[model samples]
Target: MFAASIKSKTQSLRLQSSRLMPLSQQYRAQSNLSNNKSYWSHIPSWKGVSNDEFVSYRWQLRNTVSDKLKLYKFLDEVLPERLGSTENEQLKRIRTRTNFIEDAIAAIKLAPMAIRLTPHVLSLIDWNNPLDDPIRRQFLPLRSSIIPDHKYLELDSLHEEQDSPVPGLVHRYPGRALFLATSICPVYCRFCTRSYAVGGNTDTVSKKPQKPSRKRWEVVFEHIANDKSLQDIVVSGGDSYFLQPDHVREIGERLLDIPHIKRVRFASKGLAVAPGRILDDSDPWTDNLIAVSNKGREMGKQVCLHTHINHANEITWITRLAANKLFKHGVIVRNQSVLLKGVNNTFTALSDLIKSLSDINIQPYYVYQCDMVQGIEDLRTPLHEIIDLDKQIRGTLSGFMMPSFVIDLPGGGGKRLVSTYEKYEHGIATYKAPGLPGAKGEMTYTYHDPKPVKTAVLEEFQQRQLEALERGETLEQFFAQSAAHLPRSPLPNPSSNQNPLRPQTTSTDIVPEFWAPTPKPAYAYSQGM
Candidate 1:
């Protein structure tokens, strides 16, 4: 009877697997539109350009729309007058308000991750409706970035620097290492996690580290070579692809030489932002990548390309072409996306994105909660919302299509499954997980809103004031009565360490309290009073 039960379970598992196989195959078939000329014809910029020039990676790089002025000129030609005028006004305002310090900071941040959008990606923007365009939102700077409320946000949100033993290499996970190969990309994302470092900015918000030199790289390679435990290495930075093709090949070869290194993964947004770089067979970069993949195959090691793409609209004909090229070279392609609030946060948007990736043979890997980087509060969604969205979409997506919704805990705690909220209270959720750095046995983390939390007392004060007015009390009388009942205390000296609102603990594990307002008297309210 036990044998029969085991047989039944195995059969059930096989049946489920078979059911999922066909859906993936079907999507792959639907995604192949190489013969579809109509789709390419609709892009206005693609008109008058021969297929050879359109597919040339060099041409794409040479014609990138880099500066604000260049982007404006392109928009002026393609967008409606009204939309163009609005964008121009916003840009003009930003330019007018720029000061020396602000300009210095912007220059610093943009240095490592310079803005350079290829024509193919530029054409993907819906110029008539740029406000809601996910692609546009990802690359373009916004006015909300200048808001002062974001001062409390951390410059190094993930504390990646704290985990790094070397200048370029971050050995965070036990078996995996992160190699920051370059500090450049085709286009700079406004919410880039490494905005403090990657761009060639000399004046960074965080403690700026020196650029990785050949000598520094030698030290990094030596460190990896000496470590036997590390089996996987993630080659990334501004974008790994931004490194010269020969340099990329050399890095891959060096990693493969390390006996314990079983897998080497390259992370880049270039596949989506500048597909022609790898899609064009004539491009030297494409050839070099192919050679590297071939070498990895020879060594019996896994070589993969993990591309960053947030929206389904980003998966275009060129993206598919690039993915297919990598596929042919025996490089497994996957996607890792950030769950930006207005970007791909909804179930429908995420569903479409993963499905589109699956259609092109790109496995959906991780959907990370946006980090608490300074000036990026607008992009982050509440943890509960991210968890709910994951739950809503889990049952509907194919197992391969469902990416893990993860949050890298602040202060080098490593990645945690966002769904693992052990307890929720007062807009704060507690997550307990083992093996977290600096945690003692089942470490508990508290996640709260970045915005100021309104205390119950404050709410009650407002409510009582409203009720007093309904009873026909004058504003002065209400204030006078309230003041009479309130408790008095000696004002704190500016130099004292008597802050009641700040966390009093000495433990480094504590998350700082977001509220820092002056203390108020405790209030007691009775139902009939």
Candidate 2:
């Protein structure tokens, strides 16, 4: 019976592949286009172009010519100037791969693939053109934060088991534990903070750690049961939803048995990276989500599916259908996005993304600044750009749709809010600022005013605020600090024991509080002060 089912699924997948453009054919099309020299004159210079400007240019030109043809022309114009002197053949290879993907996407028939192609289009962007500077292009944070990857299990480090659970099971938080379940993903992101574990193609994980055997799942449960302080288990892997339905149901049952484990959350990118996995009702993973939700409810635990979607364009019909199914099964839905340099870095892009997510009943969660994995240096956007983009997004978006922008400190300290730094310039740090762009610059708003201006006071004040944040201040503390609201001078430096950028336990984790559901608002709450 099992063999029959497996064979049935394989056949179904093969059928689906037939309707799709074969990756090989797509590659050949792009290669043929690139070899044609006729389109070279239309190619534009890569110089003096900001990522946003480049995107605008692509959209403006998209109708005039095919994306593949445009890319062929683009490469022709820039290759001579950029690749002529560089020995890093890797960059050239990536460009070629990108060209193929772009051409394929331009002709894709599936709605989900169309949405998926949007990020690929954005990825080809160049945000660091020196000529683009001073133009102040918006960007997502793709750098290492206070929380570092070193704190977690490195990819190549494990061998005894297929998967293993870390001892610090319950991180700094009382009710949350990070569950490393799988080491697989359909697409490898360049700026993944957990790059050491995800995207096996990169050599970064070649010498890291491996997961222990399934027996280790019990070890994870034992840790959760022993730690009365913890009540929720965040089931994460390269992507938790990647697990089979039976595995998910079994994990759910185990968590449900633990009276203390009140929630089971699946952190999965499958909904975004490989929505097809979830689109087919016959897919076991799709069944797993329903089964897990049922088990959680039966055990009285809140079951939620947290999806990672970085752009508005990623909301495809397949993902939308999958999200709806999860919700119908009594599973709450939420989304987390990582801010990256060339992808969804602008206010317009973020605003569009949030609106789309909200429309599908997925509450916007954290918009994490990118982590500090090696090779992701290309994805880091300036901190100031994130702040500026947040400012633009705050008013237009509903409060629920606005995610807390954060930087996960390196060395496993945990996530620290990045958007709170806006308070440094004003004389005082307050939750609601007085000088937002449209609110008459006097009315109160969610953001705070920077420390008051004083040539003498400015630098010192910024230093203090920066120091405090590095110390792992919560979103509330970072923005709420004022001369009157703070403790005595020489205020406790949260990061005093280590570099602020590296991870340290933040105030939120130490408190003996259970993970509580955010209270639903009575009405459409505006970001009114």
Please tell me which predicted candidate would have the highest TM-score against the true structure: 1
lDDT of 2 at 209: 25
| TM-score of each candidate structure, all chains considered together | 0.71, 0.52
lDDT of 1 by residue, 1-529 (tens): 9999999999999778655543223233334434534333445666677655666778888878776566555554565544322342223323322321233234323222345677767777776665556786677645323221122344455566666787778887778889987767777776787765655432123224334367878988999999998999998876877778778888889999899999999888888887766655455666666667778889899888899999998887767766876675577888989998668989899999989999888999999877765444456678877889889999897787889999877555678898776776555566665764344325665555444323343334445544665676632344456445544343556688776333332222222232222221121000000
Task: Please report, in order, the local distance difference test score of every candidate based on alpha carbons.
Answer: 0.64, 0.47
Q: Best by lDDT, which number?
A: 1
What lDDT score is found at residue 432 in candidate 1? 64
Stretches of candidate 1 off by over 4 Å are: 1-47, 84-114, 144-152, 202-212, 436-446, 450-529
State residue 276's C-alpha deviation in candidate 1, in Å.
1.3
Candidate 2 lDDT (Cα, 0 to 1): 0.47
Q: Which whole-number lDDT from 0 to 100 does residue 74 have in model 1?
A: 58
